[model samples]
Target: RRSVRHAYCQLCDEAFRSQDTLRMHLKGEHQDRYCDTCDQARLLPSSLFGSDYALKEHHVQSPRHAYCQYCDRHFRTHEVLRQHYREHYVQSPAHAYCQRCNMHFPSGAALFDHYRTMHY
Candidate 1:
């Protein structure tokens, strides 16, 4: 009889033939609700299952996650939050206001087309 060695996950009691598969399982199933502090300390699957509110509360209490009140979204970092703000709030502008022509357009695409044709 031949025996096969496999990587085992202690958290879920799952085993895989390859380490990569075990890692993928950990990341996909467990890391989604992980705690930043606990994760830094090598703690896997920090939050309990079916505790999304608890996870959200943890993020709100922690400084690592950036929360946007306007959009009601959470970002992992300040750079991501800035990028989101620029994309959805600042660069796009209001639906009708055009930055280049200093006028109002019926739609944002129309303003973009005006800028492309008239300004550019």
Candidate 2:
């Protein structure tokens, strides 16, 4: 095979060294996902992913999605998340909010946990 500059995966757009490596990646990483066709596909199978919820968590937490799983809401932009947190924390007396992270929690304990794991 001739040397090439880069080989891109149609599935996830991840670049590889060669076509063989890309084929290997597709057969391994792409095959493990719940979807068979496309890496961008969001169809999840409970039977296969019953033990692992990483993808599900990623869908909610990933900034690219502009979604807030805690509030069960979707925003137009990721910046809306900060606005939502500010409004929610200010309106709800029982809720806890972190200004630095622009995130809200149901309770102070949850916020503390976030601080310990993420910040401290």
Candidate 3:
């Protein structure tokens, strides 16, 4: 005789034949981690995923989240903002150039990397 096993998801009370499948359900579907709008279970459960997918897809398509419209580049965070400004400051000709390379860098991090490899 063969034994039958059932796996349960605590969040949605959904059951699956395998524990791994049930875990995936809890993590992906119930958690709303993938698509934010689809998080609502009361809404229609279409075989096709809807708005949630669309929103995430749109965010991915646009490269710039914290975007400078003039530069057409997206920044990872606020600290990057400071770094990017350095690029502008140096080009203004007021800032001192590095002694070794005579090349300008936008941020201290960029300048550090240039000095370490190029100068050394």
Q: Judged by TM-score, which candidate is best?
A: 1
Greater-TM-score candidate between 1 and 2: 1
Worst 10 residues of 3 by lDDT: 33-42
Better of 1 and 3 by TM-score: 1
lDDT of 2 by residue, 28-74 (tens): 77654533222343333643433335555555655566655444465
- For candidate 2, the 10 contiguous residues with the lowest summed lDDT are 34-43
Q: Each prediction's TM-score against the native?
A: 0.40, 0.34, 0.23
Query: Alpha carbon lDDT of residue 54, candidate 2?
Result: 53
lDDT of 3 by residue, 1-101 (tens): 85565976554566688966765675577544232222223233542234654444433454434433223344676477557646643344434345455
lDDT of 3: 0.49
Pick the winner on lDDT between candidates 1 and 3. Answer: 1
Ranked by TM-score from best down, the candidates are 1, 2, 3
In model 1, what is the error at residue 116, expressed in angstroms?
39
